[model samples]
Each structure stands twice: as structure tokens, then as C-alpha cells.
Target: MNNAIKDKVIEILSSIKSGVDFANEDQIVTGGILDSIDITEFITALEEEFDIEIGMEYMENENFDSVDAICEMVEELQEA
Candidate 1:
């Protein structure tokens, strides 16, 4: 995974109640590593840092669910 994306995940995970030791993709998202507020804040930070706009379709948890998922999304947007 990209260092930037990984770092961002760690940043968001730091704020959550559960420990942010994501061993797998499902654990991070379904395990409640991030909530709605965290999502909004993360999107804002992502937009600012990566210079990409997260459209409505990309806002869903399925896309931004985990650190890996969000990293993939960022890579896709950056590639585009």
C-alpha cells in the first residue's frame, strides 16, 4: 500500500475508540474502526492531501470502508 494512504489510515484510526490495529480489510471497516463523523473528516483530509474530489458514489462504506479500501480509492482517483 502507498505510504500516504497508509499514513492517513493510521491517522483516522488513532481517533477511534477501538484500537487501530487492522490486520485485515474486513476488520477495519466492520470492526468499527471508523464511524460517520470519522468518514467525513477523513474525506476532507483526503481531498486536501491528495487533491482529489470524492464524489457521492465514492462516499459509501463499501468504497471507503477500510484503510486498504480507502487506499485503493485514493489510488484510483489519483490515477484518473
Candidate 2:
């Protein structure tokens, strides 16, 4: 399930920009893989894909920093 989420996340990231190795690049926001526009698009994609709402409380750098972190957040949300 985690791998599936990661794969989906990678797919979404690729939609924003191609040829970027998201598997290795953990610092997605810091590394500038996702800019403001991309993050906006990412948020929409995430909400739709995960069927969860990312409230303001979950909007943090730690949550969006890496694919693993995002997957963990999605899992946590699902569990809740």
C-alpha cells in the first residue's frame, strides 16, 4: 500500500515536471522540485487520489518534504 501511494505520488510529481528522480530526491519542496504552482496542483492531486482533506494543520514542510513522509501522512489520515 505504501509502495502504491509512493508510485501514485511519483506519478503526480511527474505530471508537474518530468525527468526528475523523485525516488532519490527527498527534499522535494526544498530542492525546488515543486514550486508554489506545483504544490497547489499537488495538493489537489493528493486530495483526489487519497480521498482525504489536507487541512491547514497538516500543511507543513515535514509532511510534504519527501514521498515517504507524504505516504506516512496519507496512511495516518486513512487510519484516523
Candidate 3:
């Protein structure tokens, strides 16, 4: 995974919900670190930060579960 993407993702997530170790937390969605509203805000932030639109197809818990997963999704979207 890209370190830059990972760092940006962590920053974005932290902005939405503070005091959570996004880098080490693998169950962000399942563990309830972010709610529905936070997820919406996060997606918006990610779109602006990465210049990529996160469509409904990409809105899944597995996609946002961890920093690595988020980086992977961002990389995939960037490639597209």
C-alpha cells in the first residue's frame, strides 16, 4: 500500500473521529468507530483529498475497515 495514501486516509479519518488509532485498527467499520454520518463526511473528504469520486459501489464496510484497505481503495480508484 502507498504510505502517502495511508497517511492521508488516517488524517481524514482522524479528523472525523479523534483518538482512534486508524493505522492499527482493522475493524473501524465493524467496531463502530465511524457512524453513517461520519462515513458520509469521510467519503466527501476523501473525494476532495484524492480527487476521486467514491461511488455507491465503493461504499462498503470492507473497503473502509482499515488504513490499508482504505489505501488500497484509493489506489484502485486513482488507477481508474
Top-TM-score candidate index: 3
Between 1 and 2, whose TM-score is larger? 2
lDDT: which is higher, 2 or 3? 3
Model 1: number of backbone collisions? 0
Candidate 1 pairs with clashing backbones: none
Instruction: Give the better candidate number (1 or 3) by TM-score.
Output: 3
- Model 2: residues >4 Å from true position, as ranges? none
> Scored by CA lDDT, what does every candidate get?
0.72, 0.86, 0.92
TM-score leaderboard ranking: 3, 2, 1
Q: Local error of candidate 2 at 19, Å?
A: 1.1
Winner by lDDT between candidate 2 and candidate 1: 2
- Residue-level lDDT tens digits of model 1 in 1-80: 78867786667556543565553556544556677877777778788878999999886767766677778888999999
Query: Model 3: which residue pairs collide?
Result: none
lDDT of 3 by residue, 18-73 (tens): 99989899999989999889999999999999999899999899998988989999
TM-score of 3: 0.96
lDDT of 2 by residue, 22-80 (tens): 87888988877788788889999999999988889987877887888888998988888
* Model 3 local distance difference test score: 0.92
